[model samples]
Target: MSGPDRVAGRTALVTGAGNGLGRAIAHALSAAGARVILVGRTLGKLEAVAAELGGDSRVAACDTSQPAEVDELRAVLSDEDVSILVNNAGIAGPVRELVDVEPAEWDEVFAVNVRGVYLMCRAFLPAMIARGGGDVINVASVSGKRPLARRTPYTASKMAVLGLTITLAHEVGEHGVLVNCLSPGPVAGPRMARNFRLEAERTGVTSAEAERAFVSRAALPRMVTEEEVGAAAVAMLRMSGLTGADIDLSAGMIGR
Candidate 1:
């Protein structure tokens, strides 16, 4: 469990495994020989990723935000000993002035980004502790480290994740569970494009301009690649010395 396959012989449960960073993490872990459980909302999308993974990897469709769904998901995984848990499922809520955003939309954002991660931990973390040492990597964002204009809900939810990761790390480290957060900046994907479009509409600037602004804080400003995010995640899973800390993969983005 400490070589090229750093997570070898461990079972990893990754949420939002349908695409983007989540997919990249799943691929990286599976390539390293971890038994991967792909959990997401869409079975079809999970199936597609499962096919791409094809090994001992599996698909379990669940909405991380729903209590009942999370319980069922835990039951589905009860038989398999999960040694790694990656909470990557999240949603970018409506981009608008805080006052302009609907309360429901704001709540939904927290439901998925905050409560969802909470539920997953609630279900799987104790089992890992009871069995002995394990790892939990929570995917956060650079926005959580600073304020982002017009993306209040997304920013707030990510901040909550940071806090949760830190507090949980403190609580679980004694139990041999290491919890950490990986805060990536502007990971290139359809999601980033959508965020740019919304920011453009908010600022009356072009989406292209919004993209530049999104990475303005990066000393070496650029879009973060999916492969880089994947590698960072794998690194986190491998590192045993760090806990309750956020590993920033934001291309030197200056945080406020």
Candidate 2:
């Protein structure tokens, strides 16, 4: 089975589905025949995505960083057979040096990027294990494995996600669950553009120059796209043999 056949009849819940990678993933999963659940902090944004999906797809509002909100969301989704869980909710912490980063800022980043993944897994993994199989895709970043200047909290949180994915896979392998993560490079989006602008301000260069410097490290010398990330998620679902793997969709950044 491939393409739509791979995910047909499955329910996929994607966090941060209002925009960026999450929105793209929701669209991809829906296109692949999965009943998608658009989850995010903004109800209006989710509703917009839900309308765009225009099918059995639905929207739910919840702050993944908050345990209470996650618990409430789990209860609301208790009746759905969510076989595919995409823990895509994350936040870019303060773009400043480690010393300048406030303690609360660091904690907030971990709350969404790390603790959010753990909470979602804890809420849904039992049912998946009981069902004898499931798929989990934790969205991480290449920055997790590399040294990114002035991104201490986001980098650290993503690295934690990588560890969580692999260790969780090991523990659930016997039960037939597959867990993996995508460590994408600098994707071409508003997020990256903002980062580029900030970098230009910090490094005394034009935005284009800052972007060039960032992508020059990659063998392909370009950022990935949101659609590409979505397609990668679909491909991961199709490949049953893959588990405990960190797929680097970074335009050969890791290779270089």
Candidate 3:
């Protein structure tokens, strides 16, 4: 089949766009002609990306976990008419056994992965439905599908996202809004590198060795790429008939 049509004239709000997959998605959307809004906590990083996108791009620096800040963000965007919302802001926090995990750490994970997406959807979905139709892509993880060894908080947060996506898809499908979760297996990005580094520190291995070990667990025996995930997000956004589905861009690891 031919590639999806360019999203020209559409406006997209991408959170966690300061780096990694979110940044890649923002670039892809901008290149596809969407008027992109880069949202993240770091103004300098967001501004740098905004500068690269050039046309009709804006940056909003707000911590997604804060409802008041999200409200301010909504007020700032009240007139922009956003047609796409990508809830990509997330945190892995510290890896620890569930029994040993602190309540505060769990809350932090939920704050960004679950609550942040909830806030973004609540703020943007109305405008999208009002404008006729739109796409909402929540960036989840393979951890959401099944438990990982020491990622209790991260896993829980992503599972919540998956549930949220399904629930919202049902609520908004008739209104022409598509909601879905994009679960990527270990993508080769800054975030993945950080995760690997943390694992290496915990396991007493070199970072390179740690990454190699982790990639070996994947069916493809290789790490996925940010561009690949970005492409999947584009595909999901264009899939008008698809909703409430967990799209796995996992490089053959889902069933394995």
Candidate 4:
């Protein structure tokens, strides 16, 4: 299970890379010999991940959801010829019915999950196109397709991500940019724990019980791991011509 890492020539910018799934993918890209730039809002966390990677890895504490910050970060990366962009930044909007959702909360979630992707693509895709080819991997979710109940904002945001992936793929195919989405099911991480807690509050069940219910939807008896999601992301990095496609690393979750 070993071969030469071919990503040495590539430079990858991973957003939300301070922890969780973002951190795992950053590590994977680095392990595969790519120069990785870790981007997140938390300086301490991003620094910690960068130190662990222990290469020429760089860190930029930038909140992807903020247009000004995204622009500043883009300027910081202007010198580097970024060849791969992994839009992994996201937030879980409040778990509530569509009518009960707050406008502020909805904007908060979309600003990060949806608008951030748009800004990043706009900021970096031109350089990628000019350089000949690149990868724009958007981290989406199963709820994007199956529409998880009581999570209107999160679901809608991801559906937008899915649609964006497809349309961007078509728009940039002539420019050698491959746009695709990675839809992961419940993964064992802090985000999943938070989701369980939210579900418990919504359903009057224990977090443990809610977690089991979530996993039961998957074909497997358990949720997937962060490393598994990282592997899926790395796989997407190596493939081409998969524009407008979604690779669901959902452990076969039954679609509703």
Clashing pairs in 2: none
Q: How big is the positional error of residue 21 in model 2, measured in Å on the Cα after superposition?
A: 0.1
List residue ranges in candidate 2 displaced over 4 A: 1-4
Candidate 2 on 183-212: residue-level lDDT in tens? 887899999999999999988999999999
Global lDDT scores for all candidate models: 0.89, 0.93, 0.87, 0.87
Candidate 3, after superposition: displacement of residue 21 in Å? 1.1
Clashes of 2: 0
Q: How well does candidate 2 match the true structure in TM-score terms? A: 0.97
Candidate 4: tens digits of C-alpha lDDT, residues 68-106: 988898898889989889999999888878999889999
Query: CA lDDT of 92 in candidate 4?
Result: 85
Give lDDT: candidate 3, residue 223: 80
Q: Write the per-residue lDDT of candidate 3 for residues 1-256, one digit (tens) a residue.
A: 1135637678899999988888989998888778899999999999998988888799999999899999999999888988889999998787778899998998999999999999999988998788668889999999888758889889888998999999999999888888889999788877788888888999999999998887776779888899898888887776667789998887766774
TM-score of each: 0.94, 0.97, 0.94, 0.94
What is candidate 1's lDDT per residue for 1-256, written digit by digit as tens?
A: 2345458888999999999989999998888778899999999999999999998799999999999999999998889989899999998888778989999999999999999999999999889889878899999998887778778999999999999999999998888898999999778889889888877887799999999987776877887888898889888887877799898888888444
Comparing 2 and 4 by TM-score, which wins?
Answer: 2
Best by lDDT: 2
